[model samples]
Target: MESRPKVTPLTRPSARRSHVPPLGVHPTPDGGIDVAVAASHADGVELCLVDVVEPHRDAHDPARYAERRFPLDGPVYGVWHGHVPHVRPGQRYGFRVHGAWDPEAGQRHNPAKLLVDPYARGLVGDLTYGPETLGAVSAPRRPDEPDSPDGRWWVAERYGAPDDRDSLAHVPHSVVVASHPGPPPLSRPRVPWADTVVYEAHVKGLTATHPDVPPELRGTYAGVAHPAMIEHLTSLGVTTLELLPIHAFADEPRLVAHGLTNYWGYQTLGFFAPHAAYATRSARGAGPAAVLDEVRGMVHLLHEAGIEVLLDVVYNHTCEGGDDALHVSWRGLDNAGYYLHDGASPAALADVTGTGNSLDFRRPRVVQLALDSLRYWAEVVGVDGFRFDLAVTLGRTQHGFSPDHPFLVALQTDPVLNNLKLVAEPWDVGPGGWQTGNFPPPTAEWNDRFRDAVRGFWLDAPREGSHGRPMHGLRELTTRLAGSADLFGHSDPPLVRGPVASVNYVTAHDGFTLADLVAYDHKHNEANGEDNRDGSDHNLSWNHGVEGHAPRGAEGGDTATEPWSAVVPLRRRSQRNLLAMLLLSAGTPMLTAGDELGRSQGGNNNAYAQDNEISWIDWDLEDAARDLLDTTRFLLALRREHPALRADSFFLGTPRPGEDEPDLLWFDADGAPMDREAWDMAGRRVVQMLRPGPDDGDAHVLLALNGGLDDVGITLPPAAGGGSWERVWSSSWDRPEAPDDEADDVTLESLSVEVFLNR
Candidate 1:
């Protein structure tokens, strides 16, 4: 009954405000840090501060730092925030979000476990995963469940309780930084998507072994921006450097347990933070600020060299994993809102991604988080664009995948984002997940159909017989070579996506390299420790006259004890043919990194987990490798010179009224017109594509294909000017000392591709 001060309840409700303003660590005039984070279902939120740990240690040592917590005020629009006094750009911090612990309902919030700030722009160190730090508890496989590929997934349940596990010593804390994070070298290159050649390279792998890169700078951001690397990219005629994910990511705990690492950097932890591991050791010694400068400086130098930087972003999933996984950020802050959950049990995640969890696109705040992250990278970090990994998951709804999803629409219309180049992987492993060529205008999607079709013609032949499928037809190959109009342009309103929508490539980062495509017919993934069953078996590759590397054969082609050289001719010619098919096609072409230099992974198709020599590019180029490099540069230059080769629109097949000749003319092996009957031939293996000269250019291009086992005569179609055809380039270039055999019949050898210029 005496005067006792009223005690405040722990739960505080946040309301949607009229003018909510921005979130995350914004700098204030008084030199304090304004911290904000979005957590709708949280009962409370606190910004925790820790003493800056210098010379960062990896162990879970408690005596490393001091800790203090400050409760945030009213969460405007479900965003809890507060301005911390005496805080500057270098202050170290983390979040302790206090909420419910009901995993069954998909709300696994525990303040005892420290969480990462979702909007953290700079990360300090690597995530130290353990039983308590990772939170992924396991049990014996259940009898009722079927076996999984990894066996550990079939009966696994990510559900776990918030143990009173204090992860302060093990968990990495986010760093406070200046409100304006970067001054990217220049504005977005805004390269025309049609003219763009995406060179997909890993930050570390691209420069890790380059000889000219300073020993200390090798594998660092500086290495990628070094003059040596820049010269190679520029000489290759690549307009954009599409780097593999450099976002702050972690090696999957299971990958670590298997004695491997995530070399691809797909297991992202923080969307706004660059992977600090890729920075030079000197930069790490300096501080996080130096790391930021190094990354920004790389981008700046790239822009100066007339190149754009696009990030391969993995926003579909995070390193937080699922119910049994770690509570690094979103899972601990507001699990139910951040992820899609099973409607019936709620606790079980609706993981469309192979990863344990998929980001929920239905929630507005969740969409905002992704948008904010994209803006941070595009505007603050100065990246030209993004290639969204598992992009179908980003457009999914409760009803299934929707091209008209809110997130997709927002991406197309956002003032700042619409101008940026956006590419989608276009598929996931879930139901109705293959949405290739379905995404709307301006956003290009990876044309896997094109990839398979090219591979089908060049590598997978009917009689090759190494687990390869039969070739569809010469017409099928033409359809892909002409930008796969049947797939991307066959829409109700005519062509939904033009020729530019298809990113044509025979090889990508996910599958075999140009060299390995012809070197090994089967995958050898024993180093992954998964029993060689981790990668796809549909390689469509041929061993060309030997497996792995055999002894040289006698003059007639029989090997006794020496390594065989019989397969070498077909191998080199095949590499040139594949390269020609990619660049000469009428679509945006993407060249995988090191493919020009004939890079190989020792027949390993899936090297995602190999962080060593297996994944790093071998800079020491062999003779064949140098030839392939020169051939690649020649093809790229040809593509740039011939406007007819890079058509802006799909060919109508029939002649246009005003044109002197048809936009594109198709022919069979005997020079006859490709009628319906000829195109329908299942065994057909020869084709001739005649592209007339553009209005301004004089070069009329002819692309001929001979997939037959023996040489057959090819007749040139009559040209508009009635001029003879001249052989400009051939896939079967000088193999050692063998000149292309010229003949009156104009016969071509088996599996050969040739290009001609009609005067």
Candidate 2:
């Protein structure tokens, strides 16, 4: 008979417990690990030590692995704690809390559902979406039961009973990770807000189809850190690289049923754990520890290239979803405490986000969870900052969205978080959720108003003629083009929230690409399995008479047809106009990943589910794409070199003591100063904006924009301080090559933009 290895017994590390144990499992100085979890309503919490199963045996089968459960000591301020000797790093574990199954009171405790640690630093395995992971038995609504407002009556059925199926197999195992020594501390590239140019991209989509990236490293953390990828970012002159959600996430069952995955990764499973799928295959083969190191490597490489990494985090919701969804973590541990529920119906979830459930930021523990996760990513993971998704939900309290909400206040007060970049999406689907420009100081917001105004002035207004009405005036466009003082400025204190607070962008990941905004008026999201009914219909776009792709050669084809040959050039010019407005504006600008290269999703505004080529950026450079990239580079260089465009404070309009003209002056096509009526005139589509240099010694900048159907003559105003004007960039050019110096009179093309500098 084969001799079996001797089994060792776990020893007790200590009996004394502190006032409050730190949450999550931490390796002790002794050989053991100390585990603590917050489960307020649980009667007893058991720590389950799991043994790795054999490769040949079904690794996903819970019954295949041996698990030993130990009761922990706690309920001291709602925290459960314990210390087990012999548990080392890389050990897989989970929690099972025993409590009353009273759904009406929001105390959902099912010991059979193994729960993931909310503070787990690393996780292994993928969450299998099935009956095993669902904490409650999902039943069909009875004929006698009344329907809910959401129209899904079966969602209420989750409160009926506890599911007894063991969830150890289907759920991801939380692994104990010890702090490993890494390369010397990264020197962060803390680019100031004024000089910050955010380039929002996806870890996978950005490099998946990159031609130069090694095939094995493509679409992985290592891929982003690859030299080829870093070169692109550096060459583009973007100061910050904002990546989409990298938190460990799971695909919703509905998406999985339709043979699709959550490509956007908004559904977060483990905040602390790096999304394992994003790691290179080599790192993944080495386990969770290696996966985390890959993420750090990416950040380190980016920082080395003088680029900051900002994660688009989803703290408002979890992958567990709503009442009828799976319950792998928070819900199973303490449902009443972790999630927000309706005041009248305690069992029903309060979903401010379009997602099924929203985390209750009102609760202290929930707030603690989010803060802890953020600290881990910032300090341990080495990311420079975060862009919080659905940030308005985080600021929502019992009363409503408050600037002083506990979570928001805590972030401002926290020593680690306050110094880091904090960006808020600034809206949710909840009541009174539009809280733009209401966030605290030092926090920048995604400026949707700037996006709308720029799109309307360039793409919409000309397509839909403005018939001499005050409604289509330059007031709205100018407000956004300037610092948007009407929205971000405080008259009481003057420039309290400066132009830095507005993150201007014409296109984001959620909307149409820069090319699509000019090529398709309607969204073509037929592949999302929603029958093209999903995605926003309020896209303020103009197709320039073409519905889909322009005739051959317009978008890199062999030859071009009649109107399309003309329309395509106009579309490309419109794109340039939009890009120029965003970069030249006196606010921090954000550029979408493939917008510079003119990448399009074939009119699919929302490609959150199409994980294939539809979302991945194609690296094949066409003539138009190459020109757009060069134009982007030129604009970025202009913004970087000129302090006028990157204003630290709002323009005072009045000239400084040493200046010859007002700090900013607006002129009409006739070269005369614009009056009140001219500012509101609808048919008046041409405007010349002049901004003085930082000092009398520097060159003053001039921007002349013509947003009409017919070309107009613009008599350039005399330089702000009186030097000759030289035309630098123009949308009329096929390439970004500097245009010849022009005199007083220049013909501005229809729907085109021009930039000039006075030296």
Candidate 3:
């Protein structure tokens, strides 16, 4: 491992003592802008003030712009500081880092390249990707291709190239945004982990095609906080809106080439800036400062309605792909210092994130950059929390992943970040990357095991497709439904992360939606441009007798083009089963954007590249979709009304100290407690979970699930809640309407789940 200095907070030098107190474009007392950038090993760095020739540009064309450069004062504590008196808000600016062009020594600096300030709060214009934009220095390329240098192509053995080609014309300019207007309002409805119901939605998709959101404001940040959107969130009992990445990001060059964009916004550029594309056209015209104001305005509105906003942040890698040839942004500034490199050779990247390059958290400078960006968003943007995408990369050390890594410790102890809802997508592609249950206490991690287990039980039990094998045994399901104590319940150091540590969900943005899980057995990812080989094939899904949507007629027939009306019951019931398990289970539940309404991506499991109708939510729901929405509302309501469903602590399964009945009672098909053999056996698909409310409370919840293909009668044990059973909900019911009374013994329909409440 390359040796580097560690920066403990106590030992770190103060920025104010050296002169510039803050990085990025901060307003001065005298109306100038103080711009600071961190380039640790750069020989020289210049702040460039650019003038725009036009607000728009053509594709594969040089941006109409020019630049005047000013040398930064010093490399003080790795930060280059300067004050530009002429530059103000909306003023286009960027940095030109100068140093060695050697790649083996971990330096790819070319003054011809325009680098983005890592702390840019507002990025103006989008990066136009071409040879000039990607790199000014010629990189070794294909033997057959011509080289484009100085805006002209040369094909003389493809060897002629311009060394002095300035890439400023195609590079994005970082805008000097003035400080935010006053302070963001301090009122936040910080939802507790137990009661928090996270609705994971992309900011644009949530409102883009909504009927109620105004036409002009349909896909903007303002639309997300609009009254129409807020009303839906409130009505659905959503406590937190976990938005997909809204940071300034660039679509992958491949996706752009295919005329598709990164809809999920996973690839990040400026971590501090809100994506300008998602802002209103007026906001973009008003300039970069208004873009941030609109984001804060969204937060303020959601906070007022007692809802929290959690951002899905990507800190693991930059949009600068792994190619050492690209001299833009981070790669241009300090390639060696910013990103992790293979120890054997610095030219090759050690990318654990599978995103081309992994940011080196081992370096304190990069750590400071992330910490600063987070503080900016939480304190300045006024957002509630952050869900770190591929968070395992952040906590990975030189040896492997560590729970007590410097960055993890800093987050747990840092005052600003400690109060926020820190979530981790805890796994990467590197060695020992599966750290799902390994994150420290007081934070949650997305539980893929929970996802797989649930999907296997409901969808994979009956079929042995090329997709995968049969269902996982009852033991796995029981463990996941009860908060996966075997995983997250760490007794070491006496820190037992409770049920809330698991962020339980069966579907997310990267995979098939809940609707697709019921409607398709195979992925239809032809729209993603990679043919059908792009998305995951191991989708534990069962198409209800037909692929895609089949009309609601021909109930008694079985043919190739059969309407498959009989298939509808099992599909609907299965959908209900997934949602009920997600909401009622002992963990923090995350519902995807359109999953509540049975939204289908036409079986495209991975829709990361699809930005059009296939990805944008269709809010105008049909009859069946509307029914799923109502079911979602009711499920959320049940979870809210009963504290037992959202348990703060994990159930021990054994009887409590003075009570004969355990908090949770698990049983098999015959209403008998599950024994060792039953827990390990397959084909025994019937299970009942009985949960008692708070101590001495009269209400309780009983959930019965039968995965069999035939209706089975099961006897209900004596009521633990001390009242007759009211059939609160059933997956098989056509309407799923008002609750009906049921006898002690009830017949569960094939492929169904039933809920009963003792009141």
Q: Best lDDT goes to which candidate? A: 2
Local distance difference test scores for all models: 0.79, 0.85, 0.80
* C-alpha TM-scores of all predictions: 0.92, 0.94, 0.91
- The alpha-carbon root-mean-square deviation between model 2 and the true structure, to one decimal in Å, is 4.4
- Tens-place lDDT digits, model 2, residues 424-463: 9999999999978888877889999999999888877766
Q: Which residues of candidate 3, in runs, are more than 4 Å off?
A: 1-20, 53-64, 136-163, 181-183, 465-472, 491-495, 551-563, 657-660
Clashes of each: 10, 0, 0
Candidates in descending lDDT order: 2, 3, 1
Worst 10 residues of 1 by lDDT: 147-156
User: Who is ahead in TM-score, 1 or 2?
Assistant: 2
Q: Candidate 3: deviation at residue 224, Å?
A: 0.9
Q: Which regions of candidate 1 fall more than 4 Å away from where they truly are?
A: 1-19, 53-59, 135-160, 181-187, 462-471, 490-493, 550-563, 735-745
Candidate 2 segments whose C-alpha is farther than 4 A from its true place:
1-17, 139-156, 180-183, 466-473, 551-558, 657-660
Model 3 residue 664 lDDT?
Answer: 91
TM-score leaderboard ranking: 2, 1, 3
Candidate 3 per-residue C-alpha lDDT over 1-759 given as tens digits, one digit per residue, 9 for 90 to 100: 422222112122334537755878787878788878888777778888887666476622345564677777667877888787856677878888777766666666767777788888888766765566554334433222132222322111111232456667666678877776533556789888999999999888888899988988988999999999899899999999999999999876666656678888988989998999999999988988888899989999899999999999999998887653345699878888999988755367898988788999999988988999998898888888999999999998889899999888888899999889999998989999888889997679999999998888888875542235554445677778888877788856543778898999999998999988988989999777676778789998888668886654442334324446567666788899889889889999999988887788888999998777888889877677788889999999999998879888888887778878788988776778877887767657789988887666657888998876678999776775356777888888655695546778889987788888887
